[model samples]
Target: MDLDVFVAAHRAEWERLDQLLRRRRHLTGAETDELVTLYQRTATHLSQVQASAPDPALTSRLTTLVARARSAVVGARKSTWRDAAHFFTAGFPAACYRTRYWWVPTGIVFTLLVAVIGWWIAGNPEVQGAIAAPEEVREMTREGGAYETYYTESPAAAFSAQVWTNNAQVAAISLAFGALLGIPVVWVLLMNAVNVGVGVGLMAAAGRLDVFMGLILPHGLLELTAVFVAAGVGLRLGWTVIDPGRRTRRAALAQEGRAAIGMAIGLAAVLFVSGLIEGFVTPSGLPTWGRITIGIVAEAAFLVYVFVVGRRAYLAGETGDIVEADRAAEAPVAA
Candidate 1:
């Protein structure tokens, strides 16, 4: 390649790209497409100049032009608020709705298991004894005692921040380690179920079941639902590793893994709301009905968000995956 002739030939195209990028307002559709085409061609020219003819001045100039053109072609991303709005309205809800089949069953099974364990412990003094001594149980259930005091032990704001961080960490772990054949997800769910069962059982045995429910329902409903959503998405990711369907295992995992990450972020916001409720409403002087009503309304709004907005987004082609340009480049696979 004759460096001078090559530069002379492509110089016009490069200058055109520079002009398009400098425009203050939007380009017409045709001009936009032309800018992209010129950007690609100039990038190729830069590579050839670098490889076949290393002219220090020419190389630097082409490099700058290519970089600028590339940025203009790709364009700046939307504002943070816009990105957030899109995630909640489309990405987050779609992910929840798509994975509903997995999480719904998980919620049901977990509820049943906790109920059974609670009933067994409530009815059998021996079972309760194996778990904890009667005096210890009494300490927890005594009016104005441990279970009730736990929520109010810390200042509400600090308590809410702490709960949000802890719950977010749990959700992050569930999704991050989901590819480990889902064992961690299952373990987390079982651990939660056992802990809740013990509380319910101990409370019931001490004739404080109603008190336990009144305190818990205020925040527990939304908190647990967020957890279940994370666990379900994680389990789905693990299954993708085992069976990738028509796509290669790598491709399937990549798709599902990205979706799982999106869910993790969305769940962080969900858990934050629940944490506030737990720290404020749960421990507040508000009557049981008022607290529970707040919880129920929040939970219902989430359900509607998922089933209605999510389904519509899914049908409209949202997969909760990273936007195409942001995704890693993949080699074409033969059908």
Candidate 2:
């Protein structure tokens, strides 16, 4: 309890510990051992001072020193690069693979819906007239018309950024609104289907179906797939809210929410590729076959990334959630 005597007794040990910590990078085996011993002794002194005669400046200094020493002894975590590598290699892909059951149906149903709507618009003259003026439809579907100009109007870099931003926003909205029992997700998917259908129907009616496909396929293949993935995951999240199965509703939401977040990040990268294709390849002087082939290859690569790489990660027990150490402790559930 004698403050000055306590300080005088511990000052040398504290200084030695501080010195060892400072030279931690260059420490030898014997010096490392000494550092640990000193760290423990200094910690004890800090405790004694706290209980007996705590001083504001001394306490803060000791706290910082102890923290630094602990870090040195335990070693710091890996950098952001390792975290990112794991996410792309395992976490993101595994989540997508696991959730494929949800999104596969979404993609199929969306395709069917678009086809049906396209058929209706293309076949029905009244529907076509109701949708747009004949001149407008003709102008849009004409050679070197609105559809082609749309891709080329802006500089490639600016257009790529713009498309990426817009698609990312759509994906974010689907994931964010998923908690509302998925009603908004349904609306999002339907709206996308309708818009696509309208375009296709108008083009087909104008006898320019090839033009529509050529322009759209160069980017739409991957872009729409990413959107479908988001909508599907959102609906799945909403379903968890309605029926949590073995998990409590809160637990289900938490798990699904984490997966949704991972999907959002993964989808952003996917959308970026699609945006690049739309901005660059779609507008480039490449023939329609060449542009479409590029889009197909990108889309195929993504599927392989999801199914092949993701399946491996999923089998290895990676969930789409944060690593176990980062997650909150959950109570055991009955089997």
Candidate whose TM-score is highest? 1
Q: Cα RMSD to native, each candidate?
A: 7.5, 9.3
Candidates' lDDT values, in order?
0.87, 0.86
Clash totals, every prediction = 0, 0
Residues 1-335, candidate 2: write the lDDT tens digits: 88888778888988888888887889999999999887677666666666557798887888788777767776655549888899999999888888899889999999999999999999999898897788887788788888779998999999999999999998989999988999999998899899999989888888889988999998999999899889888988988989988875666788899989988999999999999999999999999999999999999998999999999999999989887544433434455
Candidate 1 per-residue C-alpha lDDT over 46-81 given as tens digits, one digit per residue, 9 for 90 to 100: 767765687999889877887777567676565589
Which pairs of residues collide in model 1? none
**Model 2 segments beyond 4 Å from truth?**
1-79
| Per-model TM against the reference | 0.78, 0.77
